[model samples]
Target: MTGTLKLPHEGTPGSSAEGLDARLVVERGAFRLDVTLTAAPGDVVALLGPNGAGKTTALRALAGLVPLTGGHLRLDGAELDRMSPESRPVGVVFQDYLLFPHLSALDNVAFGPRCHGVPKSQARAQAAVWLDRMGLTEHSSAKPRRLSGGQAQRVALARALATRPRLLLLDEPLAALDARTRLDVRAQLRHHLADFEAVALLVTHDPLDAMVLADHLVVVEDGRVVQEGTPSDIARHPRTDYIAHLVGLNLYRGEAEGHSVRLDAGPGITTTEDLTGPVFVAFPPGAVTLHRDRPTGSSARNVWRCEVAGLETHGDQIRADLAGELPLAADLTTVAAAELDLRPGAPVWATVKAAQTHAYPA
Candidate 1:
């Protein structure tokens, strides 16, 4: 422990600068990451995206493990950009629980506090409290290799919290656990995060994790934030095709005029909302209907000759991925699928009512 080790706050209730204020830009070997973010105390923000999207890079920048080419990082109100990882009032739970192989769970949890100058006896006592909170008191003497995946994750979390960080960053925290273990650990982690008054951020590609664990979602792609909002908001109104697909909606970019939109490709679509200029049109796969032949005198204004490119069973329904004038997806029940005799390379007519389509300004 150094004399310069500073506590960001007196207690968890009030935080350093408000919570966290970060605007980061890091350029590395032709890849660039730029993002701006802010969160109040008690807020849990998630950075979600596909592989190589720089979610880990942004997290590394906040932890001072990676240098920023531009922008700044502040937690509570103290500037952390110039500080080293250990000097900042931040704690991280990495994807892999990096507990020392030779150490017991109790010792692993005590190490952080001990390094920060807490007396050995005092740090061990505090470690016990955290282990108890994580339901690992009985396994405190077990080594990392002896613990289960879920147990190891709890110890890592306990160890991080033992240091009393005002900013908690978890990178793929549940990635190592199996499906059943992940569910249990995820539920436990949610409860702990709710009790934490400090700002928390996590990086993950799992939509369920982002939806259940975070209060806000920052969707990143190609080194930039494509969308950011509450989970419900992002689910209901996706701003980009990637997000739309992520939320399971078929999206299209178009120019809107009144109740109709001229799609960038294929035919124009009539929608429920009246909008002008560049716009986005979206609809659910379940809203689409497929017919063997083109029918007339139907209320549906959007119809296209589509060929089924593939079909797969999705729970109780079947998902058909189609390509044609409009590339889209359609969901149908097994009975309907059997009746239509749907298959790959099959010609089908797709129809969607104007009222089923949603249009929003781009």
Candidate 2:
């Protein structure tokens, strides 16, 4: 059980040690997918998208569970497109934590080693080591049915890691947990995943999970990769409406002249940047200030007259959905909203300073 498994074929001396290089294409009845992806060793790349965006399909292709209609898959420089799921040096933890109900936690983790030809005793020994690492030694004899959701998840993780895979695929690792358990499990998962030297790919629609757990993000839409960058980069300047909504920002595409940008929706916004040509204007809801009426002596360059279409509490703040000359979203304190007597159909003026508005080339 402690012996080294055969390493996957290395491409070149300069290539990354434990990453994935793949150009995956899968076609079903009416849907088509084409995505080229790469991840560096120890990089946690999250495939983020809404349902039917092909995130799961891509991950399955990487795991060799789904056959590729075309394109290549290489893990740690070894060709995997032709390998069977069992032959590939990959590990996967499904969302449901598919542990055998009849098996003890110790036996569950030992299954992989036993399948790989190790003796039962040796396999259990290795499994015990992994369980210990996961802080599950005391529960080694517990059956899967008797384990808590988080405990079962850890057992699943330990089972996968015990195999020492070159690539790890996780599908919604924290989705099955309750709100209270999610917070604890999320932190533990982060620590374990960080220690993994192999490439890890996670598929999740939850932005909080993606932002908190992954170092980089790959955003897919309509079966195509629309964007890929670090979490902070995507958060700072989102190019798509889906991404904007994911990162909680209001985005507008427009043409820029000097320090001002003219939106296609018939409004011009001033910005600190002095750029010309096609641009994107983005501002968080918190940057917007709502007023009952246009305030005099206001130096703010960008002001719009709008009517409150709706209001809702978002955490400690109030989100005002407005409709009028230009539809926009603004966030204010609940106290402020109450003081302003903000309500549906209330006339209001929204103001945003040029410095607070960010403009980037579209």
TM-score of each: 0.93, 0.94
- Model 1 residue 171 CA deviation in Å: 0.6
lDDT of 2 by residue, 84-175 (tens): 99988888999998999999999999999898999999999999988888888999999998999899999999888778788889999999
As for candidate 1, its clashing pairs are: 16-76, 16-77, 17-76, 17-77
lDDT of 1 by residue, 36-102 (tens): 9899988999999989999999999999999999998888677899888899988999999799999
lDDT of each: 0.90, 0.89
* lDDT (C-alpha) at residue 217 in model 2: 95
lDDT score at residue 175, model 2, on the 0-100 scale: 94
